[model samples]
Target: MPTNGWDTHMHVTDPSYPEAADAEYTPGQHNLSDALSFESTIGINSLVLIQPSIYGNDNTLLLNALTKLGTRHGRGVVGFDTDATSFETLQAWHQLGVRGVRLNIKSNEVNLTEAELQERVTRYAKIIQPLDWVLELYIGMEDIPKLEPVVADLGVRLSIAHFGAPTLPPIGNRTLPLDPYTVAGFQSLVNLLKAGKTYIKFSGAYRFDKDPQYRGIEGIARELLKFAGDRIIFASDWPHTRFEGLDIHPFVEKCLDWTDAAGVTEKVFSRNAHELWDIPLDK
Candidate 1:
């Protein structure tokens, strides 16, 4: 942990909670106890509880966790009906330490056409813009071209999940296949970073190329670091969804090594996250 540093992305899910009826999987009653204990033991002082997909639009678990963790130590990004959520609800959540809204496409059971999804996201962004809350996206890098323009026009800050999850082309014949779609999407992300229109999480390493040492994600991480050092933040993805019981110490070490650039590790692990999530802590 980075002492009073922040973990910008993590979740609080329990089996006792009401999961979405059509959820793909049921998370065991793993609430904030483990995460809180782990963070305390490791010296991390704050967290941003990202709503997991297993609960769909239900934010009960997330909200309760935030309350328990207290505003000073916890903030959250919750899932809600973008179209139907009331302004009062937004205000209330903000008062209770919610700082962002999530638009998760990965692991979502509900299917909507591209246009419909974009429309809802736009609406949600508009709703939260007045509160100065961010829109956290779990979509692929390929969708950036289509989505970025819409969000840019909306005038809301964006935070992308999982290192943008670049779709790397297959390596064959001792040659790298730089797929145009993936390449373009990634470039668009870089453009967004340079423009200060978006931020990204240096998280979910397990979701990317599963080379045990996480060597495959280096290129993307290095690229983002070059464009925006403070815009990149770190997370443990604890409880390590789907891949439970993961020892995150190695991943933490990897984060430090990969961000070995002067002062970059501090920014990624602490300063940047505090700014992004508005953790109530001193500079």
Candidate 2:
């Protein structure tokens, strides 16, 4: 198949970094060359390399890869300390096709006080606002309520990572495991969609459920699709972290399956991504 789709989430490992050893999940022996090969196989022409927790704020590896790919094959979603990164630095990154920054509150294994988190997000908004970059949040499901006001206050485009990072058991329920809190959070996503302030990537199903077939996981994905079809974007989470054992193709296929059901494959797989990230699509 000819590659034409855009993968909104993936990580490329930089062996040169000493921190690679500490990674609980690292992309398997795959460099940018390997990633391009895999993307070719899956019919993915472009990808967004998210900053993995292992790399922390050291984005040298991701930056180097983007430099090599030169924005044709790759773009980046980087992580940085707002205190450390200057607005001019963010502007330079944007010129290189970085349209968003990753905030990994959950995987970084650090809990922030509500005030501290707010301060950090607020500072980031100040820097990123001028560049028109969105904030991509990787946080736990329970944290969404606290995050709502931060997102509202910042007023930058927001993208939630990994289906709001719901707890594994409810995801494992294999039926529509509905809880009041989860229902409320799902509704919040709908509201964000309606307001045109947020987008959610349908990736990381493996993190949500161990079953590769993703039995019960489909229900949650379907519900999210129902809430916001065009606002949804599909991703492979390729070389799927912590679950490298699973084939990348199946992950992409499952996302396609959910998009098909939602009747938003065109937008989710291609259109919305281009519009959001400013990547060019084949006409």
Candidate 3:
């Protein structure tokens, strides 16, 4: 394990804080204490506590956790209405360790037309431009190719979460063990990675490959590692929503495989996160 590591994606849920009225999932009590304790054992010094969809824009839980973690020590990817929200509030959040905004189109399963998708991300890109923050985009596998033009001129830091695909319902017919290689717009996403237009977060292995070892979809991960490793970022995705009680070590070890080279692991785990969060390693 690297002496300093960053788990770039994870959620912390509290039973006391209710889920949104339209919440699709009522998560269990995955508290901050347990998450931090587990992370400590794994040599992870920093965290990117992402805002879960259950809470919608109510990031009280995430901000509260950041209060405990201290600024710069803990970072977040939160959700908010870019239009209704003011830039001052965003700057306040930045002071509290929020480095980006998460545009979670995947959770609501909303399909946007090319014009609509472009409008949405473009608006967000413009909103966060001044902050120099990254946009954590989550969209359907089919919506990715549409992003080619969006990123070509976005001129902002952004990342595609959960490998940016495999949110696809099913490839052809088979469901559970979907091969990420077959994900719609898979090649276009790779091209974006190669062009350094956006970053692809390699997490959520259990989403596609049901096998604990993720053997079925190893090919897809390997292909990205081979071609776009420079833009790849590994995240533990701890307390993996809907995929609980799973050992993160195995998934982290899988990342180790993808990041076998000395320089590769350093970039994927620690260095890349620093660049993304704009936080110093010792912070």
Best candidate according to lDDT? 3
TM values, all candidates: 0.90, 0.88, 0.91
Judge candidate 3 at residue 38 and give its lDDT.
Answer: 81
- Evaluated at residue 149, the lDDT of candidate 3 is 82
lDDT of 3 by residue, 1-283 (tens): 6756788888899767888887887777877788888888678867898999889999999999988888656898899997688889999998999989998888777778899988988998888888888989877657888888878777687798887755444334555444556767887777788888588888887776666666655656777777676677878888878777778788788888768843488878888888888878675
| Model 1 agreement with the true structure over 1-283: per-residue lDDT tens digits | 4556788888888877777876788776677887888776556868889999888888998898899988888889998886678889989999999999998876563456668767877888788889989899887777666675576676788889988766654332212222333454887787778778688998887775566666667667766777589799888777788888777787778888878854588888888877777764573
lDDT of each candidate versus the true structure: 0.78, 0.74, 0.80
State the displacement of the C-alpha of residue 162, model 2, in Å, after optimal TM-score superposition. Answer: 1.2
Q: Looking at candidate 2, what is the lDDT of residue 174? A: 33
Error of 2 at 64 (Å): 1.4
At residue 144, candidate 2 shows an lDDT of 67
Error of 3 at 221 (Å): 1.5
When 2 and 3 are scored with TM-score, the better candidate is: 3
How should the candidates be ordered by TM-score, best one leading? 3, 1, 2
Candidate 3 shows a clash count of: 0
Per TM-score, the best of the predicted structures is 3
Candidate 2 deviant stretches above 4 angstroms: 1-3, 20-28, 168-184, 281-283
What root-mean-square deviation over C-alphas does model 2 reach? 2.7
Taking the tens digit of each residue's C-alpha lDDT, what string does model 2 give over 1-283? 2245788888888555657444555445767887788888778768888888888778887888888888876779898877677778888888787888888887756688778777877887777887778888887766666666667668688888887776645543534443323443555556666677788887786776677677655666777777578777777777677677577677677877778777888888888777777687752
Q: Pairing residues by index, what is the TM-score of model 1?
A: 0.90
Which consecutive 10 residues in model 2 have the weakest lDDT in total?
Answer: 172-181
